[model samples]
Target chain A: MATEIVLISLLKILVVVLTILTCVVFLVYIERRVSAFVQNRVGPNRTGPYGLLQTVADVVKLLMKEDIVPRNAYKAIHDLAPIISIGVALSTFAVIPIGDTIELFGRQIKLIIADVNVGILYILAITSLGVYGITLAGWSSNNKYSLLGGLRSSAQLISYELSMGLSIVGVLMVSGTLQLDKIVQHQTTYLFGWLPAWNMFLQPIGFITFVTAAFAETNRLPFDLPEAEPELVGGYHTEYTGLKFGLFFLAEYANMITASAVITTLFLGGWHLPYVEYVGLSSFILSLVYVGTFCVKVAAVMMFFIIIRWTLPRFRYDQLMNLGWKLMLPITIINVLLTGIVLLILH
Target chain B: MGSNGKIIRKKDLNFWQRMYIPEIAKGLRLTITQMFKPKVTYQYPDEKFVPPPSFRGRPVLVEEQGVERCVACGLCSRVCPALAIEVQASETELEKERYPIKFEINMVRCIFCGFCEEVCPEEAIVMSNEYELVFTSQEEAIFGKEKLLTPIEKLRPRLEWLKNNR
Candidate 1:
C-alpha cells in the first residue's frame, strides 16, 4: 500500500510538473499580451490564433540557437546551473494543493503531489535554491554586468525574505496549522456575516507585507533591480543560450506562478469561498472548478504584478534595500504583533 | 504633545492609520471602480481599433491620376533613415518625362520615422493609418508597385489638391 501510494504520488508529480511547464510557456504569452495592451501596441499574433503558440516558436528558436558557455566559466557549476533552477522550480509545485481529492478509477487521488506538513518551508527552501542558478550563471559568465546582477539578486532575495517569512507567521498563527490544505479548510467561515472567508480582511497588514515582500523575493518590479536592463544587459543569464538558457527563463516564470499560488493560498483563502460549500458538485467537477478558481486567482495576481511593472518605476538599489530592511521589516513585525493581539482578544 | 520634535510622526500612528484602514479602503474602492469601469482595451484583429488621425504609421506611396507623383527625386528614399524605400523610375511615353514605374518599399526594414513623408517634394509618399501590414513571408512584405501604390480613386481628394496646385 505504501509503495502504491508512492507510485501514485510520482504520477501526480509528473502531471504537476507538466502543468507548471505549460503555465510558464503560456504565462510569457500572457505577459506580452498584457504589456502590449497597456502600451497601446499589438503583441505577438503570428504563430497561432492571437499568437497563442508564439511561445512554442520561441522555444524552438531558443533551442536551435547556439549554446555558448563562456571561456572563463567554471565548467561544472555553469553546466549544472539551469538544472538546479528548473529542478527547484518543478519540484516546488509538489506542495501546491490545486484542489480537494477526487475519486477516479476506483482510487482516491489528492489534488496535490505531496501532502507535507512543512509545505510552506519546502516552498521557501526550493525557491531559495533559484539564487544558486543566478549566482552560478553570473559567475560563470565572467562579465561585470552578470556579476553585478548575481550579487544584486542574492542580496535582494536575502533582504526581502525576512519580511516575507515574517508576513506568513501571522497566517500560521491565525490558522494554527503549517499544512496548506488545512489552512484552506480554516477559511470556510465568515467574520461577521458580510465579510468573506478571506484572511485579507482580518490580516490586511500581513497581506500587504506578504505581497510586497513577495514581489521583491521574485525579483519583480519595482524590485527587479537584479535584471534591470539599460544597466545590466541580460543579467546573470547573459552568457546562457539555447535549452540551458531556456531552463532559467522557465524557472523565472515558474517562480512567478509559484509565488502567485503561495500568495493565493496563504492570504486569499486558497480554494475556499465563503458561503459556497463544495457539497453537490462531483469531486472531479469540483476540482476542475477549484483549479479554475486557483488559476483565475493566480492570473489576477499575475496581472496585478504586470500592471505594477508598467505603472511603477523600478526602484533604485538603495531604495529597494531600504524599503525591504527598514519599512517592510518593521511593518511586518508590527503586523505580527497586531495579529497576535487580535487573536488573543478574540479568544 | 510638548515634546513634538523628539517623537517621530510614524512613531505614534493612530489605530486607523496604523491599521492601514484608510489606504486599504481607498485601494479597495479603486479596485471596485476599475472592475465596473469600461475596459479601455481594444482587441486587435478580432476587434480592429480606430487609431486617432495623428497616429503615425507605415509609409504609403500615392499614385494620382494614373501617374506616380513621386517625381523620382529620391528625396523620400535618400532622406529615409531606415533606407526602406526603393524607387526605380523610367521615362514615360511623353517626351523628356520620367515617372516611377516600379516603386517598392520594404516594410521589414522601414522604421516608420515619418522622415520620408516630411522630405517628399510632391507629397507622393505619406504615412498611412493602415497598420495591418504584417506579412508572413519576406516576398510579400517587400511590396512592389502592384501592392505599394494607393489607387488615384482612393486618393482623389489629395490628388485634386495636387492637381489644383501643380
Candidate 2:
C-alpha cells in the first residue's frame, strides 16, 4: 500500500512537470507569433509548420554555444542563480489544483501534486524566493548594468508582492480556506441561481489588483523593468550565455504558465465546468472533461498575457514605483476591507 | 487646449482616461485589430523581390553580338568614386578598335553609386537588377571581364529606362 502511494505521487509529479515544461515551450512559440501578428508581421513560420519547433531549435543552438564566465565574476553564485530561478518557478506549480479528485485503480487521487493545507501561502513564499535568484545573479556578475537590473527587479517584485498578497486576502476571506483546491471548490456554487460564484464576481477590486500584481510578479511587459532591454541590456542575465541564459528564458515562460494557473484556480473557477454536472457523463469521461476545461482556461489566460505584452509599452522606472506603491497598494488594501465587510454582513 | 500656451500633462487626462483599465482595453482592441490585417512582411527566398528597371544593382559591361560595346574609354574608371574599376586598353581589329585587354571591378569597394554607369559615354556600362551579391573572400569579389560582360538582352529594360529618363 505504501509502495502504491509512492508510485502514484511520483506519477503525478512526472505528469505535472512534463505538462508545465511543454506549456512553456509552446508559450514561447505563441508569444512570438502573437507579437508578430500584433505588429502586422509574420514571425518564425519557417522552422517547423508555423514555427512549432522554433523553441526546440533555439534550445539546441543554446546547448551548442560556449559558456563564458567573466574573470572578475563570483563564479559559484553566478552558476547557481538560474537554477534557483527555474527551481522556484517549477516548484510553485505543485499546490495548484488543475482538476478534480478522480478514482483510479480503486483509489482516490487529488490532481494537485502537493495537497498542503497552506497551499496559497506556499505559492506566495516560493514566488518571493524567485527575486533572490535575480538579485544574486546581478550582484555576482561583474557588470554595472546587471547590478542595476537586479536592483530594479528586486524593488519591483517586492513592491508588487505586498499588493499581490493583500489582494489574495479578499479571496481567502470569501472562500474561507488557504488551500487552493478548497478555494476552487468554493467557487462551484452559484450566485443568484445563474452566475458562477467565481471570486472575480464576488470581489472585483481584488481580481483587478491580483492580476496587476501577477503581471508585475511574472516580470511581464509594463512591469518588465527588470530586463528592460533599452536601458539594462538584458538585465540580470546580461552576463549569462548559452544554456545558463536559456534556463532564465525558460524560467520566465514557466513563471507565466504558473501565474496563469494560479489566477485560474483562484479567481476564474479552476476545473469546475459550470453546469456540466447536469449532463450526467460517466465518471471517467467527466474527469477527462474536467482536465480539458482546466487546460483551456489556462490557455485563455496565457493568450491574454501574450496580447497585453505587445499592446502596452514598458513603464519608466519612477512610474513603475509610483503605480506599485501609491496606486496598487492602496487599492488592494481597500479591496481587502470591502471583502471583509461584505463577508461579515452575509454570514 | 494648447491656445492658452500652457502644457497639459498626462495627469490632466479626464476621469475615463485616468481610470487606466479602460484606456488599456482601447489599446488592446487596436492591437487585436492589427493582428488580423494583411501582413506587410515578404517571405524572402520563398518569395523574391523583383526591383524596378530604374533600380541600381551590380555594374556590368553591355555585350552585343558576342562582343562588348566598350571602346575601352577608361571614363568609367575615372568617374568611379570608390576607385573600384580598372581598365587596360589595347588596339583591336573590331569596329570598336580600342578594346580592353583587362577590365576588373573590385566589388569589395563598389558602393552601388551608379556613377560609373552614368559616366559611360558608350552606354557600355549599366547597373543590372541582380542584387544578390556574396563573396567569401576579397579576391573573389574582384570581377574580371568574363563576369562583368552581361548579354544586352538581359539588360534591355535598364538600358531603355536610362534612355527615357536621361
Candidate 3:
C-alpha cells in the first residue's frame, strides 16, 4: 500500500510537471501569436505550421548559443538565480487541483500533486520567494542595469503583494477554506438555478484585485517595469545568456500559467462548469470533462493576460507604486471588510 | 496653447480617468477589435514582396541585349557618397566609345541612396527591387559586373516608373 501510494505520488508529480512545462512552452507561442494579431502582424509562422514549434526552435537555439558569464560576476548566485525562479514557479502548481478524484483500477486518484491543507498560503509563500531569484540575479550580475532591475522587481513585489494577499481574503471568507479543492467545490453550487456560485460574482472587487496583482506578480506588461526594455535592457537577466537566460524566460511563462491556474481555481470555479453535474455523465467521462473545463478556463484567462499585455502600455514607476498603495490596498481592505460582515450576518 | 494665449498646463484628470479602469477597458476593446482585422504582414521568403516601381532597392547595372548600357563615363563612381561603386573604363568596338573593363559595387557600403542610379548619364545603373541581399563574408559583399548586371526586361517596371516620375 505504501509502495502504491509512493508510485501514485511520483506519477502525479511527473504529470503536473509535464503539463505545466508544456503549457509554458505553448503559452509563449500563444503570446507571440496573440501579440501579432493585436499589432496586425504575422509573427513566427515560419518555424513550423502556424509557428506551433517556434518555441521548440527557440529552445534549441538558446541551448546551442554560447553561455557567457561575466568575469566580475558572483558565479554561484548568478547560476543559481534562474534555477530558484523556475523551481518556485513549478512548485507552486503542486497544490492547484486541476480536476477532482477519478476511479482508476478500483483506486481513487486525486489530480493534485500535493493536497496540502494550507494550499493558498503555500502558493502565496512560494510566489513571494520568486522575488528573491530576481533580486539575487540582479545583485550577482555585477551590472548596474541588472541591479536596478532587481531592485525595482523586489519593490514591485512587496508593494503589490499586500493588496494581493488582502484581495484573496474576501474569497477565503466566502469559501471558508484555504485548500484549493475546497474553494472549487464551494463554487459548484448555483444561484437561482442558473448562475454558478463563482467567487467572481460574489467578490468582483477581489477578482479585479487578484487579477491585477497576478499580472504584476507574473511581471507581465503594464506591470513589467522590472524588464522595461526601453530603460532596463532585459532587466535582471541582462547578463544572462544561452540556457541560463532560457531558464528565466521559461520561469516567466510558467509563472503566468500558474497565475492563470490560481485565478481559475480561486474565482472562476476551477474544473466545475455551470450545470455540468446536471448532464448525468458517467464518473470517468465527468472527470475528463472537468479537466477540459479547467483547461478551457485557464486558456481564456491566459488569452486575457496576453490581450492586456498588448493593449496597455507599461505603467510609469510612480503610477505603479501609487496604484498598488493608495488604490488597490484600500479597495481590497474594504472588500475584505465587506465579505467578513456579510459572512458574519448570514451565519 | 489655450484661447487666452497662455501656455496651458495639462488638465488634471477627473476621478474616472484617475481610476483608469474605463480607459483601460476602451483600449482593450480597441485591441481586441484590431485582432480580427486583416494583418499587414507578408509571409516573406515563401511569398516575396513585389515592391512598387518607386521602391529603391539595390543598385544594378542595366543589361540590354546581352551588353551593359554603361558608356563608362565614371559619373556614378564620382557621385556615390559611400564610394560603393568602382568602374574601370576600356576601349570598346561598339557604338558607345567605352565599356567598363571592371565594375564592382561593395553592397556592404552601398546605402541604397539611388545616387548611383540618379547620376548615371547612360541610365546603366538603376535601383532594382531586389532587397534580399545576404553576404557570408566581407569579400563576398563586393559584387562584380556579373552580379551587378540585371536583364533590362526584368527591370522594365522600375525603368518605366523612373521615366515617368524622375
TM-score (chain A only) for the predictions, listed in order = 0.96, 0.98, 0.99
CA lDDT of every candidate: 0.80, 0.93, 0.93
Q: Write the per-residue lDDT of candidate 1 for residues B100-157, one digit (tens) a residue.
A: 7777888899887888877777777766667887799988789887776786565455
List the lowest-lDDT window of 10 residues for candidate 2 chain B: B1-10
Root-mean-square deviation of every model: 7.0, 2.2, 3.0
Docking quality category of candidate 1 according to DockQ thresholds: incorrect
State the fnat of model 1.
Answer: 0.00
| C-alpha DockQ of every model | 0.10, 0.85, 0.79
Interface RMSD of 1: 5.6
**Higher-ranked by lDDT: 1 or 3:** 3
Of the candidates numbered 1 and 2, which has the greater lDDT value? 2
Q: Give per-residue CA lDDT, model 2, range A36-133, as digits (tens).
A: 99989999898989889999999999999999998899999999999999999999999999899888888788888888999999999999999999
Q: Give the per-residue lDDT of model 1 (tens digit) for A52-78.
A: 999999999998999888888888888
lDDT, residue B5, candidate 2: 91
Off by over 4 Å in 1: A282-284, B1-166
Candidate whose TM-score is highest: 2
Model 3 chain B poorest ten-residue lDDT run = B39-48
